[model samples]
Target: MRLALAQLNPVVGDLRGNAERILAAARSASAEGATLLLTPELSLWGYPPRDLLLQPARLALQSAVLDGLVEQLDGLCSLLVGVALPCDDDRAPGLYNGIALVDQGGWRGVARKQLLPSYDVFDERRYFRPGDGPCLLTLEEGERLGLTICEDLWVEDALQRERLAGPDPIAALVEAKPDLLINLAASPFDPSKPALRRQLAGQAARRLNCPVVYLNQVGGNDELVFDGSSLVVAPDGSTLLELPACREAVQVWDSSGPQQATAPLSQTPCREELLLRALVLGVRDYAGKCGFQRALLGLSGGIDSALVAVIAAAALGPENISALLMPSPWSSSGSINDATALANRLNIKTHTLPIQGLMQGFDTSLTPALGQQPQGVTAENLQSRIRGTLLMAVANQQGQLLLTTGNKSELAVGYCTLYGDMNGGLAVIGDLYKTSVFALCDWIDSPEARNCREDLGLPQQGELVGEAIRRKPPSAELRPDQKDSDSLPDYSELDPLLKGLIQERTTPQALVAAGHDIPLVERVQRLLQRAEFKRRQAAPLLKVSPQAFGSGWRLPIAAGGLCSAGPD
Candidate 1:
């Protein structure tokens, strides 16, 4: 059987548009003489349709769209489209996340997703009831295809720790002795997930003694960015073909043909490249889907803002990206010059709106109310708020999307000001640590990032983020000669601790035992817990890590017991 995998991007809740996209892929596959075409999970409704799946009208519309697909694909080719099947048994969570087979005759649900993941950015169990049995689709050519959805194939305990308890779909498929196994997925990017996926597919292929096809959806859907690094693994546990990552692709594989040459396992790009692509895709899709043609950010000539500007330029074209240099009285000439030089390199427009006047004005207004001028943190935050207000006003006036530049480090400890530095429509790199911000900047300046820069349509030559901007000490520039170190631990020491506390969920005592300072660890833990409210109110950050502070991090804001119970 000639099988084609459609790694296409889908807009959430746009059933008709998604169906059309599926049809276009089907046409391309049919031209290649493919007998069957496989699409990603929830391709019609898009992944994480959320409450849209709860709507009665959208469910009815799904049926109509499927009917249209049946007619549209008639005699062309058999297409397996991912959809949410309505349950007739009147069950709670009245749908089954399933695959529908559409051909010349008609369309019907062929394979239902076995595992319903509820953790981390996914709430499938809220809407979908798990399928009870193994799904095997026997086609006209007598090709027995074992089918599963995204989370069904993630049963390996070695690769994942907190796995969902369910019947092993691969084990059930082994009993059926299927000719091929195909997993339709909407797996999001997590830096290391691509390699892990390949390994999982290889393991499953070896177990089933058949070629395994892993097809995934690609694009940004709110906080989640799907990296479509789809692949076909041979029975001997070797990858035959691997599709491109972070982009849409469609390729056909002939099962009857001779075994193709094994793709090298080590050809994967560096961590920096993968992360950069994911962020770029996230920003591009978020802005495009939200109907913003231009993007705006406060470029303070600091590392965080500078990196955001680079990504914004790459994602929304340099012409579409605009930066507002909102310098306070504390802002240095070197910082202003650096911001301007970086903007000039990227060809992005910039407007200097010095906020010294705004700061003085706020001080004047608050002095009578407070009986003195706001000093220290309050004064610093006033400067940020002024810049944020200016950026928002310009964004509203010019109809541009405002991108927040605060890194994960800032957001984690409440170093960022609420409605100030944290104000924006999307947090592009809010998942990146302050250290990661510097690392990515260094990579952009290095020669290794040249080809990747060219591919991203960024300035392909010479120091995109100049050494001056990158080498400068990390500072908010809200106060005179104020460094981030004055408020928080050095990023070199802090990010690792933050990673342990936030991502690894390590306790302060454990972190201290692991050689971190007890005082620093305890202080950081307290800050992390207390800053939950701020993170809750911050812009939706792009998720590139396994555990992000987005929808996945579900800690309570007012849990005094949890906060007080920290290490003594």
Candidate 2:
């Protein structure tokens, strides 16, 4: 039997639209002689429908959408569609994250998701009741098919540092002797996730002694970006087929059909290349889904903004991207020149808005209240706020989505000002550390990024980020001769410490034991905790790392039991 994987991108709450997307993929797969089409988990309503699942009206609409599919998909092919199954009994959470088998006869709930992930960006447990046990769907031809949803296949204790406690769906399926195991997912992108997913599928395939197909949803939903690197693994743990990442695809596989020369497995791109594509996809979907045709950013000639400019050009075409050069009096001529040069290279439109006058005016207005001019950090922040206000005004007038260019390091330490440089609808690289920003910029200027650039519809020739921007010392240019190092540790040192504290969740004492300076570690820890208010108010950033500040990091703004002192 030919099995098809329909990797789709669905908009949350758009039941009709999502159902149509499923049918389109189903029709295309049936045309290619596929007998069964498998879609990602919750493909009908999109993943993490969140509060939308609570509305009785939308749940009722879900039923109507499924009915439409039953009629339109008749005689085409049997399909396994992910859905929310409503229970009639008085279960606290009335819905089960489920899969349905739809064919000429009708549709029925076949397999429900056993593991409902609650950690990080997922809150599935809030809306779903876990399935009771393993599910086995027997086809008309008496072919037994084992079924599971996203987290069901992620039971490997060794691969993951922590495993979800639940019934082992794969283990239960071992005695069922199924011909195939299919796991539907809406797994978001993390640099380590692709390989980890493949390994998980391979292990399940070997355990079941049958082919395992893992289909994942692709595209950006809010802050989460899913890279659909779906795959099929043979019983021997070798990959039989692998789909492309960061896009939608539908392809069929037949083991009984004539054997052709097996193609080499596709290699995952370098970290920089993967990140660029993921971010571009994130930005593109975020803007398109939010009804923004153009994007605006405050281009400071700094590495962060320069990289965002390149990404914006790639995501929403160069013609649709606009940059505002809000240079203060202290801004260097070289910085201004660099910003203009970078914009010219990417073919994005740029407008200069000198904020020197605005800075003086603010000082004049505030002097009467304080009986003195706003000085030091107060003065520096005024410059940022002036630029932010101008960017917001332009974005509003032009109907462009404002993109924030702050990196993770600055954000982690509260180095950025509130309602100032941190202002935007989306933070493009808020998960990327300042050091990673430099590395990505360097890669953008290198030959390796050329092909990815061309594929992303960006300019492929010459240096995209340029050497001057890449080599310049990191600075906000808020004050004369001001550098980031003046206020914070060097990125080379700070980023690792930040990563340890944020991603690794290392204690200050543990960090100190690991050779980070005790005083610096404690200071960084305090800054990170104190900056929670700012992060809480910041824009939703594109999540590239496993732990980003948005939705996922649920630290309290007003709590502290921070550990003190270095390791003995």
Which 10-residue window in model 2 sums to the lowest lDDT? 255-264
CA shift of 56, model 2, Å: 0.3
Candidate 2 per-residue lDDT, tens place, 116-163, comes to 889999999889999999999999888889999999999999888778
Q: State the local distance difference test value for candidate 2.
A: 0.90
Which residue pairs in model 1 clash with each other? none
Q: Over 4 Å off in model 1, which ranges?
A: 262-266, 562-568
Q: What is the TM-score of each candidate against the true structure?
A: 0.98, 0.98
Q: Give every collision pair in model 2.
A: none
Give the per-residue lDDT of model 1 (tens digit) for 536-560.
9989999999889989999999987
Candidate 1, number of clashes: 0
Q: What is the C-alpha RMSD of each candidate to the true structure, in Å?
A: 1.4, 1.2
